[model samples]
Target: MAHTTERPVREREDASIGELLSAVTSDAQKLFRQEIELAKAEVREEATKAGKAAGMYGGAGFAGYMTALFASLAIVFALANVMDWGWAALIVTAVWAVAALVLYMMGRSRMREVSPKPERTVQTLKEDAEWARHPTR
Candidate 1:
């Protein structure tokens, strides 16, 4: 069976003002619902991307830590042949301390470059709310 997919395009032109207003209200409601659905889908898509990126960062961090541990072990063993084991351990500890200090300094510098607040997004949302309530102003 062929299903009819048509909207009533024939307007009475004589439609009462109340009828027109009712139709407008219905269409606006439908449009609002559709906008909400679209926003929800967009947020879901963005969240999925954020989750994947976070997982990738976590994996990279884990691999970096493992590499550092193994390399430290190898270095200590190699240095042990040239010096006492205690001295080799001390050298490795000193190197790690220096690396940690360097990382802390760089992290602090980068944090200074980042904004702590969502300034633009907050402003835009406030403007949208204002326009919605008082469209002309």
Candidate 2:
């Protein structure tokens, strides 16, 4: 006995080609707008993080400045008991300068952690483009 084979058929378009084109164009425009918005939001979030880090660095700078000023007087007084007050004051000032340098470096490292690139948005946009190119998949 011979068996008949059946196959599934693709659906036909109900609208005219121009209408379809128009619809597709509208959808594409909307998609791009949404992508732009997503990029903006992502960048804004990253920028906010960067701003916070910058503010932290500024605070460190202020603190370091204040510490240096007060520490200078303390160093001079503490050194008075040592061999020569002048020598002690100089040594203490050097130590305070080194401490400030360390704090500046720490602040720099912290700020470096914050990247300006909208990495997540870039990744999503790439995926969206890939899907747009091969939507049937």
Residue pair clashes in candidate 1: none
Ten-residue stretch with the least lDDT total in model 2: 4-13
Cα distance off (Å), candidate 1, residue 124: 14
- Tens-place lDDT per residue, model 1, 20-92, is 6677577658756765665566566656655655555555556456646876789899999999999997888
Candidate 1 Cα errors over 4 Å, as ranges = 1-10, 83-137
Show the colliding residue pairs in model 2.
none
Q: What is the C-alpha RMSD of each candidate to the true structure, in Å?
A: 6.4, 8.4
Global lDDT for candidate 2?
0.76
Q: Flag regions of model 2 displaced more than 4 Å.
A: 1-12
Q: Tell me the TM-score of each prediction against the true structure.
A: 0.51, 0.77
Q: How many residue pairs clash per model?
A: 0, 0
